[model samples]
Target: MNPRALRAAGPAILIVAAALTTIAALAYGGAADPLATGDPGPFVRWGLPMAKLLVNVSAAVMAGSLVLALFALKAGDREFDGALDVSSIGAAVFTVASGAVGFLTFLDSFNPELSAGPEFGAQLGRFLTEVELGRTWLMTMIAAAVVTILTFAVRSWTATLLTAILALVSLIPMATQGHSGELASHDATVTALSLHVVGAAVWLGGLVLLVVLRPVLDARRVPDVLRRYSSIALVAFVVVALSGFARTLSAISAWEQLATPYGGILCLKVAALVLMGLLGAWYRRLLIGRIDSANAARAAKAGRAFWTLIAVELAFMGIASGAAAALARTPPPATETPYSSTPAEVLTDEPLPPELTFDRWFTTWDVDLLWAFVAAAGIVFYLAGVIRMRRRGDRWPVYRTVLWVLGMLTLFWVTSGPVNAYQDYLFSLHMLGHMLLTMGIPLLLVPGAPITLALRAIEKRDDGTRGGREWIMWAVHSPFARVVTHPLVAAGIFVGSLWVFYFTDLFRWSLYDHLGHVWMVTHFLISGFLFVMSLTGIDPLPYRMPYPGRLVTLIAVMAMHAFFGVAMMMQSGLMVAEWFGAMGRTWGPTPMEDQYIGGGVAWSIGEIPTLITAIVVAVQWSRSDERQQRRSDRHADRTDDAELEAYNARLARIAERDEAADKAAR
Candidate 1:
C-alpha cells in the first residue's frame, strides 16, 4: 500500500481500536452477562462485536466508493477505477465479516451445541430457514457475495449503482434485527436504524474513498469533486443526525437513563456526530467556495486545507461509527416495550387511537419516521429550489410553492398523524388515509410542478456526470418510466391497485410487515401523482393526451371510482378479516361495522376529489380551446384572410364557367 493509503488507514485504525476497546470493556466490567446461564466463553463474546465492527467498516467502503464514483469521479480515470477497486475489495471483506457475524450471532442467541455432525447440520438448516434473524443473515450474505463479484467485474455507472444498491440491501437485515423484540418503537426503531446505517455508510465511505483517491486525483479537479461531494455529505449528515436522534428517543425515555453505561456510549456517539457535523459545516462554509474558485493560488491552498479537514473529519466519523458498534453491545434501559399486552398495541405498536372526530384528525400524532423524513426532505428541497430561483431573479409562481408546501404538509399529517395511528384498527380511517394519499395529496402536488422547478434550479452538468438532473431525466424518459407514466397505465394502476391490494393477500402483508406498509403508501402516492400529472401537470410529460382526451379519461376514471366505492359499500365480506378482526378493542365500531363505515367513506369522501378533478379538467379544456383560438387569430392576422379569399375565388370561377356553358347552349 502507498504511504497515501496509510494516511487513509488512520480513520479505520481509530474506529477498530475504539470499538474493540469499548466492547471488551463492556464485556469485562459493566452490567450483567448478556449470555444465558452457563454462558459461552469470552472469545464468542468479543468475537461477535469485532466481526460486526469489521462488517460496518467494509460496508462503508463498499457503498461509499460506488457512490463517490457515481456522483463525482469521472469514468476511466485512475481515481474512479481505484474507487471501484476499493469497493470490490471492501465487498469481499464485507462478505466474510458478515458471514462470521451471522455464525457468531447464531451461537450467541441459540447457544447451539458445538459439533461437525448431522445433528449440527439439521439445526443449522432449521436456523437458516425457519428463524427471521437467520433468514435475514442468509439473505444478507447472498447479497454481499453478489456485490463482491459485481464490483470486481463491472465498472459502468449503471452496474456500479446496482452494486451499491445490493450493498445497501445487505445492511437492511442487520438493521431490522435487534429492533423487533421492542414493540411500541419496533417499526420506528427499525426505520431509524436502517437510515442510520445507510447514511453512515455513505458519509463514512465517501470520506474513506476520498482519502484512498488522494494520490490518484489531479489537484485542479479536487475542488470540483469536493464541491460535488459536499451536497451529498450534507444530506447524509442530516439523515444520520435525525436517525440517531430517533434511536436515542426510543432507547432513553427518562432523564435517569442517561446516567447508565448505555447512555454514556450513546452520548459519546452523539458528541462525535455533532462534532463531525460542525466540521462538515466549516468545510462547506470556509473551504468549498475557496476550492471551487478557478484561481490557481486559491485552489492550491484549498486543496491542502481540504485534505487536512477530511482527515480530521474521518477521525471524528470513526469515533461515531465505533461508538455505534459499542452501543449495539450495550443494553438499553427499555427493550421490550411497556405493556404490549393489548392486542391492538401488540399488532399496531400502539393501542387503537381515538376515534376519527374532526378534532382528532388535527390533534393526534404517531409519526412514521421514514415518511416523516421524506416529507421534511421534500419540503426543504422544494423551498431551497424555489429560493435558488428567486435569488437568480427567476420568477416561480407563488401558487406553485404554496401548493407544494400544502402537499408536503398533507403528506406529513397523513403519514405521521392520527390517520396512521388509527388506520390499522379502523377501516374507515384507513380509507380516509387512502383517499388523502391517492387523491387529495396528488391534487395539491400535481399543480406544484416540482419537476419543472427542480429542472430549472439544479445546475446542469455537461461533463457527463450523473447528477440529479440526469437521474431525473433518465427516470422520466426511460422505457419503464414511459410505460408507467402512460395515461392509460397510470389510470389503470391508480384504480386497479386499490382492487388488487384489498382483495388479494397484499393488504394483510402491508399490515404485518413494515416494508410492505412502506410499499403500500409509496405506491399509492406515486400512482396518484402519475394519474394527476397526466391531466394537469405543468411540467413536461413524455406524452400528454389532448385536453379532450384528458377530460374523457377524467370522467372515465371518476365513473370507475364511483363504481368501486359503491361496490365496496354493497360488499358484505371483510377485507383482511383475520388481521383486523383479531385486534382486541373495546371502543368504536365492530370489525364488520367498521368495514361498513370504511365503505361509506370510500363511497362519499372519495368523490369530493373526483368532483374537484372534473372541475380542473373542464377549466383546462376551456383554456386549451381559448389558446387554440388565439393561435388561429394570429394566423389570420399574418395571412390577411388568404384562405377565405381563395375559397371565394374558386366559387366565382365555378359560377362563370356554368354561365358560359348556358350561353353557348342558347
Candidate 2:
C-alpha cells in the first residue's frame, strides 16, 4: 500500500491482524473450548478472548496518544487536539470492551442463563460485589468511562497528565485476571504484567499516533516529533524487555520448558520483540538522520522509508500482542518441585532466602525490578545532566556526581539486596534497611542536588508542552512540594512515622502487601530527603529556616530520632511479634533478641547519620556567618563607611553641646 493508504489503515490493520492471530493461537492452545463437564459453550470461551483483544488495543490507543501528546505535541494545535480525540475514542472503546469481557466472564464463571428478567440483573449485581473477577472488570469499566469523559473534555497539559494517569490506573484491575498458578507470585505477576501492558501501549500507540497524524505534519515538525517519539519508544523498549523477562521467569521453571505449547507462544512473542528492537536500532542509526536532514526529493524518499518501517514494526507489534493474549490463556510448564516450601513461599510467592550473614550483605541479591529501574533511571539522568552541562562549557561539581552515583547504588543495594531478603523475617535486617533508606541514603542523595542539576541542565520548553524540565519545575514549585518540604512538616513526618508505623498495623501491612512496602519505602525516603534538604541541601527548597534556625531544627529532630531508637530498644513486648516472631527462622537469633539488635542499630547507627547531619549543619552555619560578614564589608566599601562616620559625628556634637552648657552655667 502507498504511505497515505497505509497511514489511514494502520489501526484497522493492527486490530484485525491481532484479532485473527489471537483467535488462531487460542484455538491452537485449546482456550476456545470449554471444559467437558458443565460446559458454558463456545460463546463464552471464544468471546472472552476477542473482548480481551479489544481491551488491549484500545488501552494502548488511550495511553499512547496521551503519552505522545504530553511529550511531543504543542497545546492548542491540530495535532494535540487530534491526539486527545484519539484518546477519548480509545477510552470509550476500552470501557465497552471491559464491560463485554466482564459479562462474558460472568457467563463463563457462573454459567448463569442469559435472561432479561430481574433475577438475572440481581445475579449480575451479586457477582459484581461477591466475586473478585467480576469486581475487577466492573471497576475497570467504570475507570474507563471516567477516562473517556476526561480525555474528551480536557486538553490542557495538567488535565492530559491526570487523564493519562487515570488511564494507566484502569489497567490495574486486569492484573488480577491471569492465572498466577501454583507458585502464586501474585505481586510479581501483577507488577510485570502491568509494566508490560503500559510499555507495549506506549511502544505501539506512539507509532500509531504518528501515522494517524501524517497528513497534518509537515517535514519540519515531523522530524522533531519523531525524535521525541523515538526517545519514548527507546525507554518503552527497555521496560517491556525487562518486565517480559520477569513475567516469563515466573511462568515456567526451566529454560528447557520452552518446548511446551505455552512456551512456544512466548518464544514467538520474544522473536517479534527482537525484530522490533533491530528495527529501532536501524531507525536511530540511519533513518532518523536521513529524514531530519534530507531535501525535497530525498525527504520524500526518507518519509517513505520511515513510514514503511513504521508499518512493518506495527505488524510485528501485532504479532507480539496477539501472542501475548494467547500466552495468557495457555497454561505454563510445571514449576512445582518435589521439595516442600515454607509458609513464606505461600505468603510471598518465593522461599525465604538463605540465612543472613555479614558476607551475604555483599554476596546475596534479590532485585526488585521496579526499584532497579528507578535506580538505573536516576543514575542515567544524573549523568546525562552532568554531561549536558559539561558539553555546554558549564561545570557541575565532580563530588556531586560521585555522591549521586553512590546514593543510587546504595539505594539499589538496600532495596534489592540481602537487607531486603531478610527484612520481612528479621527485625534487625528490617531496621538496617530502614536506617539506610531513611537517613544514610538521603544524606548522600540530598548532597547530589538533583533538583539543582535538573534546573540547570534541562532546556525549558516554551511550546506549551509539559516536557521533563517543565514538569520538574512545576513539581518543585507545586503546593505539595511546599507542604512536604516545610522544615516542621518534614521533621514531623521523619519522627512521627516511627511511632505511627510500629505502633499501628502499617508495619504489618508493609510486610504483607507489596504496595504497602513500596509506600513505606517511598514515604520514609522522601521524608528523609525533605528533612535533610531543609537543613543543609544545596538545592532550592520552597522554605528553609535561617542557618541558626536550621541548626535548632536539626537538633530537635535528632533528639526525637534518637529517642525513637531508644524506645524501640526498651520495648518489653515485641513489635509485630506475630509476623516476625512467627517466621520460624532456624538460623537467626530469637525474634525478641533480633528486635533488640535492631533497636541498638537504630539507636547507635542511626545516630551516626544524625551526627553527620549536625556536623554538616554547623559547617553550613559557619559559612553562612562568613557570607553575611562579607556582605557587610561589601556594603561598607560601596558606601565608603558613611554610617560609621555619621555615628562618630553625632558623638562629637553631643560632647561640644555639653561643654557649651557647662560654660554658660559658670
Candidate 3:
C-alpha cells in the first residue's frame, strides 16, 4: 500500500474501533432508562440493545474492510492485494451474519414471555427457524466467495457468473420486501430489515470491490468501471432512501410528529445525508481532478480527503441505523388516538362528501392549454435554432439559447397549474401527476443538455478573455458531477423519499388535511423528478450503466411497483378518505379492490414508458457501438495501406540512387 494511504488508514481504523467500543458498551449495559420506567418491554430489555450492538459493530467492520480494500486496490503488491479482497468478502459476511442474528434475537426477545396464543407462538417459532432460509445474504456470501476463488484461479467466467448471481439475489428483497403495506404493519419488520441490510451490502460491498481493483485497472478502463459502479450505486441509493422513508412515514402519524423525538431523529438523519452529499461533491470536484491529472501528490491528497468524507458519512449512517432501530420498536401514529376521534365520527361529521364535485373540464383546461402552447413554442424555437446552426455550421450560441429556454419552460409548465393540481388529488390523479413530473419531465428536460449547451454558448461569445464563464464551465465539467450523479447515491434519495411519506400515518393524514396535502404534493414532485433523472440517460451523468444492466434495473423497478400495488390491495380497511378514492368517485367494491386496481395501474402502466425507454436506449447504444467499430476498422485499414505503399516507394528511390552512383563510378 502507498505510505500515504497507510497513514490515512490509521484515523479511519481508530474511528471504527471507537464506534464499536461505544456500541458494545451500550448494548451490554441495557436500553437507555427513562425516569418513569426502568424497563419498557421484553424487546427493549434484550432485542434493541443486541440489534444496536450488532449493527454498530458490523458497520464498523465494514468500514475498516472498505478502507483496506481501497488501499489494496489503489496501491500495494500484486500478491498482497488478495488479502484485501479476502478482507472485503469477510467484511460482507460478518456484516450480513451479524445483522440477521441481531434481528432474530430481537424477535426472540420480543416473545420471551411467550404470552401470546399457541398459534402466535408457533408462527414466531416458524419465522425464527426460517431466518437463514431463502435469505439473500446466504446467496451473496456464496457468490462473493466464488468470485474470490475465480480471481485467484484466473477464471473470468466464474467470476462474472458469481457477480451476476449476486446481483440477482440483491434484487430479490426489492421484490419480496419493502412493500408499503407490509411496512405499515409490524409483521414484515424482518423482511424490511433484510431488504435494507442487503441493500447496504450491495452499496458498501461494491465500493470495497472498486477500491481494491482500482490500482490494477488500466487508466482508460477506470472511468468505465467507475461509471458502471455509479449506476449500480444510484439504484441502490434510491432503494435505501425510498424504503427507509416509507418505514419512517408509516410510523409517524402527522406533521406534528415532526416536532417530537422521532421526527427530530428523522430530521437529523436527513441533515446527515445532506452533509454527506456535500462532502461527496467536494471529493468529486476537487480530488477527482488531481487523480485524473496523474499528479501523485495531489491524488494522494484527494484520496485522503475522499476517505475522510466517506468515514464521516458512515458514522452518520450508523446514527441513522440506530434511529431506525428505535423507530421500528415505537408504536405507529395511526395506532395511537391523537385526539380520541373515532372512525365513524370522522366519516360522518365532515361537511362535504369528500368527493370531487368540481367541473373536470374547467379544472384541467387552463393548465392543458398552457402546456400545449409551451410545447409548440419549444418545438418551433428548437427547430429554428437547429436550422440556423446548420446554415452557420457549428455556431453554437443559437442552439444553446434554444436548449436553455426549452429546459426552463418545461420546468415551469410542469411545476404549475394542472400538473400541480393532479399532484394534490387522492389517488389516481396524484399518481398521474407523479408520472408526468418524474417520467415526462425528465424525458423532455434531460435531453435539452442544459449545462453543455450553456457552456458552448458562453464560449462562442468569448469577447476578449475567459473569466466567469470559464470557471463555470470548469466547475460543471469537474469531478463534482460524479458525486451528484453517483448511481447508488441518487437512487437512495429517490427510493427513500417514496418509502418515508407513505408508510407513516402521513399517507392518510396527508390526504385528509390541507397542509399535509401541500406537503405531499411538494415531496411527490421533487422526489419524482429525482427518481427519473437518476435512472434515465437524458442528462450527462458521471456514471452510467450498461444497456443490459439498466434494462434489468427497469424491470426490477416495475416489479417493486407491482408488488406495492398487490400489498395495498390486500389491506383490510380504507387507507385514504372515501371522497379521495379512485377517480374521486367511490364504487361498490371494497377499499381493498380500489387499492388493488391502484396498484395494478401503477404497476402495469408504469412499465409501458419504462420499457419503451429501455428499448430506445438499447437501440441507441448498439448503433453507437457499431458506428465506432466501423470507423476504427476503416482507419486501421487505411493506415496499413499507407505504410506498405511508403515502404515500396522508399525501396525504388534507393535503387534509382544506387544505379546513378554506379554509372558515375564507371
Best model per TM-score: 1
Top-down lDDT ranking: 2, 1, 3
Give the winner by lDDT: 2 or 3.
2
Candidate lDDT values, in order? 0.81, 0.84, 0.48
lDDT of 1 at 540: 78
List model 2 lDDT by residue over 1-666, tens digit each: 356787677877787778778888887777776798878888877777778888888888988999999899987888899999988998999999999988988887789888999999999999888877788889999999999999989977778888989988887678655532122335667667767888988888888888888777755788778888999999999999998999888776788898877877788889999999999989877887787774777767877888888888888888888887776667777644445477666555667777877798789887787788889999999999999999999998899999989999999999888888778878898998999998999999999999999999999877566678888888888888999888888888889988899889999899887768888999888888888888889888888778777778778877888898889889999887667766657887888899999999998899899889989989988888999999989998999998889999999999999999999999
* Maximum-lDDT candidate: 2
Worst 10 residues of 1 by lDDT: 177-186
Model 3 lDDT at residue 647: 84
Give the local distance difference test score of model 3.
0.48
Cα-based lDDT at residue 228, candidate 3: 42
Tell me the deviation in Å of residue 586 in model 1: 1.9
Query: What's each prediction's TM-score?
Result: 0.94, 0.92, 0.42
Tens digits of per-residue lDDT for model 3 on 1-666? 342453355335433543453344334322333324333454444454444434433443343333323322222344224534444454455445544643454344343344567975665555545543324334433444443343344322223234434433433332232221122212223334444555554555555444444445555444434444454455455456555554555456688877764466556555654564565456555655565556777766765565555556556555544544444333333452334253423432222223343664235422322233345545654555555555767655454455446654654555444444444333554555555554555555555554444443333323221232454554545675566556555555545555566667787666554335446645654455444555654555567766676666667665665666566556566555453443333432444454555556566675565566566667867887999989877876979768667889999999999999999999
Error of 3 at 242 (Å): 8.0
Backbone clash count for every predicted candidate, in the order shown? 0, 0, 27
Q: How well is each residue in 129-238 modelled by candidate 1, as lDDT tens digits? A: 88787787788788889998898798777677777888887788778855222122378888898898899889888877877776777866777778777888899999
Rank by TM-score, highest first.
Answer: 1, 2, 3
